[model samples]
Target: MAVRRIGLTGGIGSGKSTVAGLLVAQGAVLVDTDAIARSIALPGGIAMPALEAAFGPGVIDPAGGLDRAAMRQIVFADAGAKARLESILHPLIGAETQRQAAAAGEDAVVVFDVPLLVESGRWRAIVDRVLVVDATEETQLKRVIARSGWAPEAVKAVIAQQAPRRARRAAADAVIYNESLTLEELAQQVRGFWERWAKSSTR
Candidate 1:
């Protein structure tokens, strides 16, 4: 049985991670792009040298790992800087994600949890289905601000970098409304999706 790869995405604070967790509990293999990105930016990771060259040594912590907060501020404040960082990191992350997915082997329904799936465009071709977790923009803003203690303006800035909710929804093959559901309810939805996916893919 070939693997069924699903791309899981949502705007910041839209509870995509929560949905990923639900899928994991249902026995899906999960690969998180953020985690892979962090791994690649760590001291001895393949992308660290390019990151250091692009951002200078100051972006590296005393412990030699990437100072994620410092790097975040730099990229978030400058569009060119963000693009440079992405240019360095994105390819590495994508390659590593594919490596991980392949290693998961056949028979696993692998879920690639990528925050910018719709924005990237490339991801659509790689995955069997795009599952978007969604919430109102107001809810997204409020949640990010509350959790991160970011100013409303900062939260909005992050939101601006993401594809609009309508665009994301339009691109999605499946949508999970995450704003009002309890974890139990979310788990049920994941289980239902899994059952259907399993039956269809096998046929």
Candidate 2:
């Protein structure tokens, strides 16, 4: 079968990562952009040269990798700096994403686990379906605090920056309501999707 490209997204505290893992276990090739970005920003990675050229050695650590903490602080404080960083990283990430997807072969179903799929405005045109993991804001805040030790305000800020739940739902071809499901229950939901996905792709 031809590859079914799925754009998966959710807010910070939603179980989107968990859902991605489930999909991977079901034989999906997961192309995670954030993971690719981190790998490329590591010492000697492809993005470092341009990144360093743009931001200078100040953003590079003693170990030669991008000083993620310093860079995070810089981007957080300056929107232009954030845009500059994105300008350096997005193309590299896009290239890598394409390479990985192509290499997944014709038979593999590729799930692009993009955190900002809805905000990007371009992903919708590429992917066959957008699967959004939905959760209430309160549920999101509590889950993030429990999992990451982030303060409530920090969680709130992260959620505030993401496309709203309504917008994400509007963009989704399917929605997985993840507010209160157990891991096993969520897996069941994913299993159902997998069954339908196989049949849908052949149509």
Candidate 3:
């Protein structure tokens, strides 16, 4: 039996991470793309030097590390800059994700937590299912602002760069509405979905 590959995605602050954590607790081997991206741009990671070369010195902190926040600000404001950054990082992230997925054997139901699954387009063919955790844009804005202390405009800018909510929801094989659920409730939902998903995959 091959492991079932699940692409899990959502808009900013849609509680996707909370749900991913629950799935992890339930024995799903989680591969977080954001974490992978960050790691790749960290000091010794594969993509760091290329990133520094592409964006120049200011993009690197005094410690000679990628300043993620500064990069985020630049990419969020400039499409070309964002594309350049993704070109450097995405392939490295994808390679690592594929390597991890291959190492997790048949029983592992691996969840690839990607924030821009739809926008990337490359992941669609590789994944068995795309699970979208959804919330209204207003909810997303409020939650992001509250959690990250980002200004409203900044939060909105990030949101603008993502695929629209409707498009993401339409792409999903499963949808988890996360607007008003408690952590416990969200966990229960993930468990329930896994029960059904696991059984179906085995058949």
Summarize candidate 3's per-residue lDDT along 1-203 as a digit string, tens digits.
24388899999999999989988887788999999888887777788789888998888877777997899888877889988997898889989988888888766788999999999888889888889999999999999999989999988888988999999998998899999988888888888888877545644
- Once fitted onto the true fold, the runs of candidate 1 whose alpha carbons sit more than 4 angstroms away are 1-3, 199-203
The reply for model 2, stretches above 4 Å from the true place, is 1-3, 199-203
lDDT score of residue 3 within candidate 2: 34
The candidate 2 region of ten consecutive residues with least summed lDDT is 194-203
- Which ranges in model 3 have alpha carbons more than 4 Å from their true place? 1-3, 199-203
Model 3 clashing residue pairs (backbone): none
Candidate ranking under TM-score, highest first, comes to 3, 1, 2
> lDDT: which is higher, 1 or 2?
2
Best by lDDT: 2
Q: Tell me how candidate 2 scores on lDDT.
A: 0.89
RMSD of each: 2.0, 2.2, 1.9
Write model 2 residue lDDT over 30-114, tens digit each, in one string: 9999899999989899988998999889999997899986896687778899899988889999999999999998767899999
Question: How badly does each model clash, as a count of residue pairs?
Answer: 0, 0, 0
- Cα TM-score per model: 0.92, 0.91, 0.93
